[model samples]
Target chain A: MIAALRARNPIKPGKLRLGIGDDCAILRPNAGDELAITTDFSLENVHFRRDWHSPEAIGHRCLARGLSDLAAVGAKPMAAFLSLALPKELTARHRGKPAWVERFFDGLLALAAKMNVPLAGGDTAESPAHKGKAGLVAADIVLVGGVKRGRALLRSGAKPGDLLYVTGPGLGGAGAELLALERNPSRFTALKVAAPGHPHLYPEPRIAAGLRLRKRGLATAAIDLSDGLSTDLHHLCGESGLAAEIDATVVPIHPMAQLAEAAGWARSALQLALHGGEDYELLFTARPQTKIPRELDGVAIHAIGRMSKMRNGKPAVTLLEEGKAVSELRARGWEHFRGSSSD
Target chain B: MIAALRARNPIKPGKLRLGIGDDCAILRPNAGDELAITTDFSLENVHFRRDWHSPEAIGHRCLARGLSDLAAVGAKPMAAFLSLALPKELTARHRGKPAWVERFFDGLLALAAKMNVPLAGGDTAESPAHKGKAGLVAADIVLVGGVKRGRALLRSGAKPGDLLYVTGPGLGGAGAELLALERNPSRFTALKVAAPGHPHLYPEPRIAAGLRLRKRGLATAAIDLSDGLSTDLHHLCGESGLAAEIDATVVPIHPMAQLAEAAGWARSALQLALHGGEDYELLFTARPQTKIPRELDGVAIHAIGRMSKMRNGKPAVTLLEEGKAVSELRARGWEHFRGSSSD
Candidate 1:
């Protein structure tokens, strides 16, 4: 299996001194760089449904989760290690090939190639079955990235008077697409390849924007919108020990989300835009004096809010709605154990 | 839960620039050192049985599997990233504490501290259940270590005349203890703490000995005995393009295996010594003329075999029996999807 994976994704000689078939993969980072490591899990049902998701989508999203985290910190992805557990039937040779697993890697390695990261090392095992029932597939991805020492962006650097910005034109497309997937799964069966507009299936990690923000020293703090905007903004505020107020009128609603609302597939576009998760867009804060660009690396950027001092009675996040209405924005995002929702 | 984990394992101010609660953990490797990364999976029933092993034991063994890999390459332990999925019931608060998960971390963090590695970062989620049956627990550990540039002990560096050696006095203690646990599960319930005698419950990784070998330039090739001697030796030889020959009489059988054989619990101690796995011992090769020490870092070492030139018709590995009869040694170690066994 390791040989098969290696053959499919040939290792390009550079930072990785040793690839697979060893005790450990050896990486030689550039001289003054610190390594950033993150791990994320993609479990069946918790993160995706086998019935609703194609194997390609499942594999793409698994690697995307880790890459997004790396991008949030403005790190260049160096290597990725995937640990996968599949049911026995999924691994059984069909026509002398394990097609499902191969397609899964096809999706994963595609993203790795685009992002210039190597699939360095991994471990594979059969997911355990019980009482004759098939086991759920689970994959854990560990991403190793490199950033110049002391320059990597962090969530706790936001200060009062910092302007809040997000990459891309909008949010909530992933959630809207997921709703569509749950309602009519067959509509997306043809969506096998990864491209733009399939937000839920292949949400692009904002690596370029993050790198621009860090390289130009424009952002004071940064985080990826994995959980919904409300929850993740709350995380940024909590980490920075500050409060935030975002104008609802300025918050860009994804076109798909707007279409979902018009089609009666979702309740409200604004609600979905604020609370939907898996956007994979970068949410960052910049000094008010910094001349933030309208678009970064071809992705539209919008200033939607500002950081504020934490008052004794004020909520962590406040939403300024239209007609001068204001309300506390609770973090209704995908939090594990709190609800049956995927993050 | 992340906060609780951070509280318990407070980050020491050192190489880790950022720990948990961030997008990614940041590690600043010492100048000129290369990074070694490895990942391992611990799935329910496949790696550990809930009834046979305690949560602490499961956790310890999980980290040990990854640490042993780092040990094989003679890398100094730096940090560990763990991604865990647990059944909801196991994560539910009981008596104001999530006891099972906490105990699992207790076991994991204790080993990390002992080996001077940190609980760097991880992801946690509720394992998905199906048909109302509790979902299996799965934990994947990724260990990142550092070794002097160009000095990592790899499996491909051995020559035909190099001598093969193994750490510790014996092999198969873990496999023997596993047999005992399967026959009488309750007899091992009292084994709560990690000690030398309980090889299966808390197998110690040969990190020290590996470091000694690398720093002193002793070993030409190395691998950990996670899979049994026969299988791991096959891997080493395949990588180095060499064959091996060993004396079956000199193969060190663990005292526990001998006891199990005497008690009729095992068919033969020799079989367990040769093919049983999870010993976490280092199997390495040194130059034939080198004055190799009998003990490395206080652990006894045994010279078991020598690498030989590969012959077209000869088996990859050969065993010389008690009466000087020669026979082929097949790799009967645990392989995923090949059999219903654990590695």
Candidate 2:
């Protein structure tokens, strides 16, 4: 297993003094830089099901989870470690070889290579029991990134007047994909227009855009859209000690949102735009005076809301339509213990 | 879950610029040191069973696995992260909360506090299906440590003439504890004398001893006794292109080994010492002529073997009984995917 991983992940020279094959990978951070580390746990039946996701897609999604967190902080990836807990059945040798394990690494390594993130070191173990019973398979990713000292983008730096923007193709629509995929997989496939619109399964983490935002002093506070716009904006608001006033009509709805609406569901495109999660887009608050561009290196930026001072007896997130308060955004998103209701 | 972890793990003021609750943890390493990162995945059924082990033991063992790797390289831990994949059934709100999860962190945080390894950051997620069905629970720990720029030990630096040493209260004996624990939990409980001998369940990573060994330039190559004496020695031999010659008579047998033998197990004490794993002891090679002390701090150092120039087509490990070659040691040990035969 170790040999297979090392072969799939070729040692990247420079910066990394030592790589995989060691007891602990040795890394040297650049002078005047601070290291940023984030971890994400993806599980079978929870994050993805075997029937729904290919081995490669599972691998791609696992690493993307951690990379998205790095993007939220505007940090560039240095290296990553993976810890896999496989059901023993999956690890069973077929024709005297581990074919499935190799394929899984192929998918994971492909994404790592595309993002310039080196797969440094990790551990792999199987489930204890295998009395011919299938169990859960999990992948945990730990990403180490670096940023200039005192310059990391935080979720608590937004002021009351800060403008809130959602980066990448859009937000909220990504969550709608999960809803469609779970309710009816066949419909989800038929509704898909192209690759860029499938935000749930194939999330493109805004790594480069995040670094650019930090380097150019564009975003004051930032967070990844993992738990939908409503909940995520609430998190930022709580951290910044402010509330958010969102213009519901201006929010960009995903192409799949139309499919969800056509199915005669109670939710409209606007509702999906506010409550959907797993977008992996960058949601940030910027100074109102700053001249923000509509696009950055191909990523579309859309103004969705503005940070507002908390008014007595008001929710953290307020929905505004035609400059009048319509309703409050409730804390609803993809929660771990919460059942399929979140999806 | 976040509140429980924070309450248990108090922040230590120092190089940690930013800790948990952020998108990514920010750490600053010392100017002249390099960072060492290791990850260990502890899975339910594989590493521990919900019935056999307490929630606390599961958490402690998770972090211990990663810390042992850091100890093998003689690095001082700076901080650690945990990624947990929990079964949703365990997280159900039953009498106003998750008591088991809190206890799990209680045990994990206690160890981190004792080791001075701060709980930096991590991720938590639950299994999707929790309609009264049990799912897998797993924890993956990522430990970041530090060692002087050029002093971190490698497993490939052993010379032919170097003397092999096993540090900490002998190794092989600890693997016997697991066998006893699995075959008959009651018998294992009755056999336990005190804490010092129960190496398998409550392992004290030789972190300080490893640091001392590296700083004094006493050990050339080192590895943690995680995969038993036979396989780990084979790993070191493969890396250094040298073979090992161990005297079977000098191997320390755990007190529990006798219990396993009394229970009519086929394996003897010496056999358990050679093939049993999860010892978490440090095995290294030092200059034969060096006047090494019998003890460093409180850890016991035992010279069990010697590194020898490899003869083509010979086994990596040779076992000697009473100064005569009894047989060659085959690379047989606990393997993840190799079925129950390995366990």
Candidate 3:
């Protein structure tokens, strides 16, 4: 994770100086206001499992998870610190020693290195006495970002009439997640697995997307779709004291993910796409008619929802079906109380 | 950990401003340079175990482990996040009701609140998929501390003539660690099992002392002894390109610790004191005669060594029995690869 993270680190400017891979990652607070900070942990059982993903893939996704949260608030990641726990069984399971850790780093650190993000201080210790019986390992990744004073994006920033748009294909992560869960996933078409896993394993955090949204004065309110579209949208609506209108067909699910062949599984896919967590793509609200580009780096731009008044004025999510109002839907996103690892 | 951490947080004015508890901790740059940021994780097993610590105590110490590192470089903690993986067993064993988490918060959040530190964001999950296996818990604390345009503490800053002084008692943690490992630890000295539960349960991080050293412009080079005296001192010396001399008799040990009674154990205690890791006290070098208080807070302030030319230095540590040198010395602090978790 460290080496991969180090590999893509950008050449920091003189003022944005840092030393990665040290006792503590060191940097100068050259800014006038205080710095923005956030942390997120991805565990093996709760977040990801080795049986379903590679170490590098896990490393990359976890860092992206942290950074996406930072970007949700319009902060630019400056450094990442990774604290990892390894079961004693890792060495026995993976024959070669450093190679496993190295490959894991290859996926994990590569994302940070690209952004010149320093991999700072962290501790590594033996796994809990559980010995991966839960069939997973765990890691926590933290991103320290900087933003202009009081200019962070807030979920409450969304207002009535704001258009909800996403930067990339919205449902890719959900598709990939389902594929990951399947017994014979590779039997599925390559395209279905590619996009979601592309972002799922090694999410390209919309660091630049956030900056551009803020810079172009487009985003009024923003959030990363980490906890699936349903929960996040509800979260934004809850904070803004508003309701929402999501057009189901416009959510931009992966074109090749033949989830619909499983009959209502397509709806589950939509639900997962809407409610499946770990899509680091940006789900932000802008002016009702912001002229979003036709595409960004070939990823499709999506306009699947709109902020609205609460019915009789209550905050809720209303899905559109055949030009008629749907029941006030409970967002089927990952809920801490739900107790399910998958949405 | 959050409560205790909050309790010790120092308030600062301006854009370094943001509340601690949030989806993501917010920071606006101060205005001058970029922000210096870092995150660190402390995990159970890798960091601590429930068998040895009270929830409140564990909370405070786990978080403090990272804070001390920040203090070494004069960084103010901005926000902290916690990712707890509680096994059904340990959680229930510790009155696993959610209120226990609150108790954990009582000390943790208090510490953060004390410092005006906030709990920005974090996640909680079931422990490594088992009921009886040891649980996994992690705290990822991100520090957004200010440093002058070109100033921050570095281990490499010591000059040739710098004197090395450590705050608080040195070998006390080692003494405590011994108690924690014994099958019949209760049979140990009363001083050992007193309020603090020996060095095992709570190793007070020397944040204040390190910060004072930084603010007063005392130490030229500094590092917290998370690893042990031998390795940490060696790290400082190696970084500074200097040899060090630590007088054996001058090193402090906990008063009630009876580890010294056994034959090879006295030397072992000395070795533990020198290199026993996780003391989290500061090891720093200053001018040969730099004036510092006799004690920091209630902790002792002792001068045990000095930086010297490396030409003829045999072992970095020595025993002065009746002021005569003894040759049985070897570096025997905690080795991550070879050492057991005991020390």
Predicted model with the maximum lDDT? 1
- For candidate 1, the TM-score of chain A alone relative to the native chain A: 0.96
When only the first chain is scored, the TM-scores of the models are 0.96, 0.91, 0.81
CA lDDT of each candidate? 0.88, 0.78, 0.62
Residue B234's lDDT in candidate 2: 87
TM-score of each: 0.97, 0.92, 0.84
> In model 1, which runs have C-alpha deviations exceeding 4 angstroms?
A93-98, A322-325, A335-343, B93-98, B322-325, B334-343
lDDT of 1 by residue, A1-343 (tens): 7887778767788999988888999999999999999999999888888788888898899999999999999999999999999987776668886477877888898889899999999898888887678888999999999999999999999999999998997998998888899899988876667988888999899888888899999999999999989999998999899999999999999999999999898899988889999999999999999999899889999988999999998888888866353999999985422334222
Candidate 2 retains true contacts at a fraction of: 0.63
What's the TM for model 2? 0.92
Compute the lDDT of residue A77 as modeled in candidate 1: 93
iRMSD for each candidate structure, in the order shown: 2.9, 4.3, 4.8
lDDT of 1 by residue, B257-323 (tens): 9998998987899988888888889999999998899899899999888998999999999998763
Q: Candidate 3's residue-wise lDDT over B108-154, tens digit each?
A: 75566556555554565565544445455555554555545555677
> What lDDT score goes with residue B254 in model 3?
54
